[model samples]
Target chain A: MALKLYYDLMSQPSRSLYILLKYANCNFESKLLALRKGEHFGEEFTAINRLQKVPVIDHNGFVLTESVAIIKYLSRENLIPDSIYPKASKQAARVEEFLEWHHAGLRLHCAMFFRVKFLIPSIVGQPEEPKNIDGYLRRMEAALKEFDTKWLGRGNNFITGNTVTVADLFAACEVEQPKMAGYNPCEKFENINVWLKKVRDHFNPYYDEAHEVLNKIGKNKFKMASKV
Target chain B: MALKLYYDLMSQPSRSLYILLKYANCNFESKLLALRKGEHFGEEFTAINRLQKVPVIDHNGFVLTESVAIIKYLSRENLIPDSIYPKASKQAARVEEFLEWHHAGLRLHCAMFFRVKFLIPSIVGQPEEPKNIDGYLRRMEAALKEFDTKWLGRGNNFITGNTVTVADLFAACEVEQPKMAGYNPCEKFENINVWLKKVRDHFNPYYDEAHEVLNKIGKNKFKMASKV
Candidate 1:
């Protein structure tokens, strides 16, 4: 049986996982889950992942959730090269550092911004609160600053170092999320701006394919202004 | 040169790393930072980690932050044994899942509860907002319920399975943080109650030593209603 991947491209983590699996050319069956329709809440999907979150994988009856974990698992399974996560302890540690920092830092702020600015208004039919959005925006910018100055560091091509790792993929999905909501990430942070373009080139077709939904939304609603 | 760890025991992540290092019996020097005194903001500490967070490790001048990352790094460096993290790919992925889910789930809520219920009132000389605390309490309860039902499972001795992993260590620090503020974790969730005791027993002297400051706080001010 092939590995089963449950995902939704609209989700940042899912996009990262999808891009990783596709980029690695792993033999996995894709399971599309639409968040707007509450498809994940259905009993069938919930049974696979009680948390009902996307980017879950089931390989030979062994199930796993959490994008970072899934990606790491794939790497360990030899589905992808160790360079993506690094087998060298210190280099691996650097990637892990970026990932852990990402959850509380960038991921949190970007999700908050997306929920308040885009999801609630467009999906939930709720009025977008400018005050709430503004607070999230400020926090998001602060997180970006940290990403640019601290994590990316001075003269580093990628977050951990010269090579593009899973950290870059996870970051690209999250930092790019706010762009769909009319927030320009690159305009505010030069380093992330440059780094993102490099990551884009590295991931190539998989990145573009995984981000199809987001790109469509960007072209239609956001005027594709986020492409910078 | 021995690894130098910068930590404040009162902080959850710091406590996790501190407990891990001590439990592993790794050769390391402790650099304690008093978070309550704003010492982390000082130029000296900020130079090591610009984010100014505790639970940072400098291994022969290779500085690393984020407790999960540090723990993973230590595991990779063979400073700790693989049983704590598991060298097997699938088992390791399960541990990683718990850690990643942990940051967004329990850690976020418990930290929020601790901040609103205890930190702001004690450190900032601000009044505790019952409404805010109540909101956090509800969310914390939901997170605990999910953790107990989903992660702990029906008859698993540990989170992933029979063996105790680093996930248990990180969880012990975060989940116990609220106890000092008078929140009873065991009273609310039966599974968590059982699991926590097992984790506490696993760490023993190190757990007690690392949590001494919090224990003192619970003893003096909070009245310690959280003992299961």
Candidate 2:
């Protein structure tokens, strides 16, 4: 039986998981739960994840939520190569460190920027509030600066040392999210810019495919023409 | 040489790491970083962690940060029994899922509530901002409710499943931090109230010892006498 992945491409984590699953070349069922249509909040979907968050996976009888956990779990279950998630405890710990820091660091700031700049104005029919996004933008900027200086080690191919681990995929998806608002937050950081391209190129078709919906939305200038 | 642990008891993650280290019965050198004195932001600490966050560890010269990652790394390094963090991939993923969700969920809300309700007012010599705490309190309440209803299985002892994993230790620390402000948010939730005692009792002297500073600060009503 194939693994069942419940996701919505518009979600940053969902896109990361999509790319991960595709890259792993695993047999999985893709179940789209559109957030714009309130599909995720529906009773049917609630049975899968009461939290109503995306990028959940149901393998065999085991069900898991949280993109990082799902990716780590799937990595082990599918016997994915160590280069992606790593098997060595120390290497894995480095990846874990990035994953843990990401939640409050890049993930929070990027999502906040996207929500304030695009999601709110488009969905709520309200004008963009400068004060609302000011803090998020500042935090986003700080996080990006740290990502370049601290996490992105000198000449390191990925966030956690050499190979592109799950951390890179999750981060790239989040950093790309604010771009939907037509603003590239990491545009000034040379290292981040270079690393972003490396991650995108490594994932290739899967990355582009997973981001198609978001790209279309971004290209449309995040207008309220579409519900989500 | 004992593993070096850099921590601040007042910080939630720092306390979590302290309890985990003691519970594992491992030899570790405790290096207290007084946040109130601006120790974490100093030059010496910056060399250890550019982010200047607490709850970092140096084991055999391999320095690591992020409480969840540090705990996970230590769990493997010390060969602690599975009952604490677990070895099975499925079981481990559940713990990871909780830890990840915690960063944005309980940990965020709890820490924010503490900062707004106690830290900012006491330290900055400003009045407690009720408006700032409102959203955080609501989110904290919602997180606790979901934690009890969804994560805490009926009749189950811990967050994920039967055994108390690393998630419980980290969670108990965060949930308890707000108590220093003379507010026990989880006191209203029956399951959490029960689980709280269970987790607290499981760790015993170590749990109580790790919380000594915060407990004293909490007892003094978080007066501005100390800078933190």
DockQ of each: 0.84, 0.82
Q: Against the true structure, candidate 2 has what lDDT?
A: 0.84
Model 1, A127-181: lDDT tens per residue?
A: 5777767888898888889888887757779887799999999999998888678
lDDT of 1 by residue, B1-228 (tens): 579989999899888888888888887887999998999999999998889989789999899888888877787778888988887787788899999999988899888888888888887787687776889888888888888898886699888898999999888788888877778688888889999899999998999988887878766655534343
What are the runs in model 1 whose C-alpha is more than 4 Å off? Answer: A223-228, B224-228
Stretches of candidate 2 exceeding 4 Å from the true structure:
A222-228, B222-228
Candidate 2 per-residue lDDT over residues A106-203, each given as its tens digit: 88988988888888888889868678778878888888888888888567899987788889998899988987886675578888898999999999
Candidate 1 C-alpha error for residue B30, in Å: 1.6
Q: List the residue pairs that clash in candidate 2.
A: none
Lowest lDDT 10-mer window, candidate 2 chain A?
A: A219-228
- Pairs that collide, model 1: none
Give the DockQ-based CAPRI class for model 1: high
lDDT of 1 at B23: 84
